[model samples]
Target: MKRLLLLGVLLAVSSTAHAIVIRHDVDDAKYRVPATEFPALVDMPGEGHGALIAPQWVLTAAHTLPMHGDLKQVVINGAARDVERVVVHPGYRTLPQTLIDQAMASGEAMLIVVFLASGDDVALIRLKAPVTDVAPVAIYSGTDEAGQIAKILGKGATGTGATGHSPSGPNRTELRRAFNTITSAYDRWLCYVFDEPPQALPLEGVLGNGDSGGPVLIERDGQWLLAGQGAWKVVQGNVLTARPGRYGQVTCNVRVNHYRDWIERIMAEPAQTTAVG
Candidate 1:
């Protein structure tokens, strides 16, 4: 089964945060790295969504895994490349229990059963070869707040906008997703329309399927930073019996600040990560 992810912090979320169309826990195994960065990430068969971060790294969604294993590839000219290693946020959990407790502690606890926050969805692919093409987007030292306007790019929902079965015998898809990813999900979930500006912020556009793992970037004082990772959408279905129709709502991106210590700790041991075989 595919894994899932999301974001909501503060030990517990406010009750109002629960009512939007939230993102479910679909595996972001489709995180595609560029050849210049590393070989194509495994599990992701085709042109998966990716963005350059540095000369030797590419960032992608954490769940983009392989049917058989977990080693993100680097792609170039439609050919698979090679890689040195990968560094994912240590906080990432295939089934994170702490995150679940946080979810349950809040009125939005169900968000945990389905997915975690978007804040930790990022995965960095370190390449044996350095990429000179696409430049890495800055990994912000800070995350954006509720009303900041940000841009997101990624492949969107598939199969006529409804779910379908993969035909690649569980290894790949006979019908690959057209990764024409676009705008980030707007404030429909995090904040209401009237909530925009002055102090409270809101999403500027719409978000949908295929946008998972996309970057939410915001420029503060003319400086760019990685604000959030697109996680899940809240769709009130049979599971949410109280609500009949899926409303406009979103999950969350876990705070980047929450994982700074973890990331720094891992990066401090670069040799160990590079030695992964």
Candidate 2:
């Protein structure tokens, strides 16, 4: 099992803020989403979440996909399957050597590098066989997700801080979720800011480590559509003036509508895939 990197929290200031924040209780039955609706990617040893976007395809964050080349590394909801192919966005770039250098020089933790590499962070995993039992989620092709009610489901940790482990553990066996309204919708990203006062608490929740690659869903009529995938959490503290005001945390996702064509193209492409190792 590849040791999973902490998924959320990209800090802009030198001082450390609490890592990802998951508001629900670890075993809150109400927050748990059934495996049939959204299967947890047990690969990466339960590092992240993935949605069944098609009978044979799963959607996830590019950074969270297993790199060990062994298809056995990934087990979706206990059903083992080979990775037939993987399609990372053409524009996706993991931390470059240059960025690592900068991070090292600045005394930033490795996770900070992820915040620097945000944008086009989605990927599609082609499984060996079609998942006939699980229904695929529809991707939203509409204009934007701003101001829309969104639901995020994942098997990530539940708390804030260094040992902010979710009662669910790293490989959250049961998927949990929360509801929030989209605050900003850019051409390529959707975000939720967490600095609002308590009155706005009901309108939002935060993402935590291990929530990466999970789906952000929007309901259309009665069906839930995939609006985006959890990508990075941008944390900008008071870097200047030295007086740290209330910490600002932005939970961001790769907007699905902006890359609908690209997703279709990749899925249709010949299986010219590479091993994660």
What's the TM-score of each model vs. the native? 0.54, 0.76
lDDT by residue (tens digit), candidate 1, 1-277? 2322221111112111111111222223332223332222222333234445556655555655333654646564354546667776654555456655554354244545344433345466666777654445565564335545554433332221122211111212221211111223332123222111222222222223333444555666785555545454443332212221112333344344444455455545655445221
lDDT of each prediction vs. the true structure? 0.38, 0.58
CA-only RMSD, every prediction:
10.1, 5.6
- Model 2, 1-277: lDDT tens digits are 1112224432331111222343332334445556565553333444666677777777777777655554443566767767777777777665555644554455354455345345467777888788765567888877667888887776665553223343224434445666777888877778776544453444245556666777788889888899987776544432112121122556777788887787787777666656231
Native-referenced Cα lDDT, model 2: 0.58
- Which regions of candidate 1 deviate over 4 angstroms? 3-50, 76-81, 96-122, 158-204, 221-224, 239-247, 272-277
Model 1 accuracy (lDDT, Cα): 0.38
Model 1 clashes, total count: 49
lDDT of 1 at 176: 23
Clashes of 2: 3
Worst 10 residues of 1 by lDDT: 14-23
